[model samples]
Target: MVDVGDDAPTFSAPMTTPSGDIEEFSLADATDDGPVVLAFFPGAFTSVCASEMTTFRDRLDDLTDAGASLYGVSVDSPFALEEFATQNNLNFPLVSDIAKEVIDAYDVSMDFDALGVEGVAKRAVFVVDADGTVTYEWVSDDPGIEPDYEDVEAAVGDA
Candidate 1:
């Protein structure tokens, strides 16, 4: 998995924008503007995923104040992501890693064999600075777990 101080692996993928439009998103381009918070979730509309995403939505201003942009990454299709964003009233974009390339690049891919779900991203968060270096990383094998919001905000400030 990617760790702090490591160069972040940049990727481009389809995403559902805040304006409910489907578009391509490039991690490198996002970092070029400022720090970026990539929140990788197992799936959309799940209980823990919903809570985690809504928490991020509520705290978006804090990250933005620190000059950071946030994006929630998932293996869901962009169409599903658009509906998910609308349902959650999320103000940030939701990246669709349907091809699982981003998850693989970050080494955070996982599977739920019993549930027949595979190639989904494990719950993870990475704070990438403008220079493309990961300033902070948080990953969890437990899908129910969520990252520390305060710590992520602090990392953005430091970045």
Candidate 2:
């Protein structure tokens, strides 16, 4: 798992933005001016994922005010993410890690054989500073659990 103070691994992937555009998104682009919150979830359209994403969408102003941008990461396809974004009325981009390369790089990939899924991303959150260093990291094995928004907000504020 990625840790605080560690240099964030650089990555770029195709993502579905809230505007329904599919484009290449990169950590470098997000953190170019300030901090970015990368919220990783197992998949899109799940109940927990919907709740978590809605929470982020609702609190976007606070996050943006703290000089941070937000992105949701999942193993779902860009098309699925687009639908998910539309359904939830999310204004942030949702990255597609369908190949699971980014998931492996971040060490957040999980196996769910019981659910008949493999190489899904674990529920995690990373706050990356403008310098490309991780300022905060949170990982949870339980997919149903959500990150502490207050802590994430604080981390972004500090960054």
Candidate 3:
């Protein structure tokens, strides 16, 4: 895992955002604009995941007000993510981690026994600073707990 307070690594990858644009984005890319809240979901369209994303969507103004760009990542493909994003009305970008490379790179990939389910990225939220340093890190112990949005706002606001 990347240590907190360490110089943030450069995170760049090709992904399709929820808006249906396939672009190669990077931590440097988002950071160049401002602080980034990289919200990682286990998968698209799951109940808890949907609620969590909806919460973010509801607070999208707050996020932008904080000068933060939010991203949701999963092993699902861009097409599936697009549908999920549309269905949920999520305006943020959703990345394709189909190869599990990005999840592994962030060290959030785990074999979660989710709802007695199978492979998935453990529900985790990472607040990366403007320099790409991860400032806030969180993971679900039971795969059912949702990350507190207030905490995320505070972290991003501070960054």
Instruction: Give me the overall lDDT of model 2.
Output: 0.93
> How many residue pairs clash in each candidate at the backbone level?
0, 0, 1
User: For model 3, what is the error of residue 14's alpha carbon versus the real structure, in angstroms, after optimal superposition?
Assistant: 3.5
Candidate with best lDDT = 1
For candidate 3, lDDT tens digit of each residue in 73-142?
7888887888898898888888777877777777777774546755567788887887778888887755
lDDT of each: 0.96, 0.93, 0.80
Model 3 regions lying over 4 Å from their true place: 112-119
Tens digits of per-residue lDDT for model 1, 3-72: 9999999899998999999999999899989999999999999999999999999999999999999999
Off by over 4 Å in 1: none
Clash pairs, candidate 1, are: none
Write down the worst ten-residue block by lDDT for model 1: 115-124
lDDT of 2 by residue, 40-139 (tens): 9998889999999999999999999998999999989999999999999999999998889889999999999897888998999999999999999999
Q: Is candidate 1 or candidate 3 better by lDDT?
A: 1
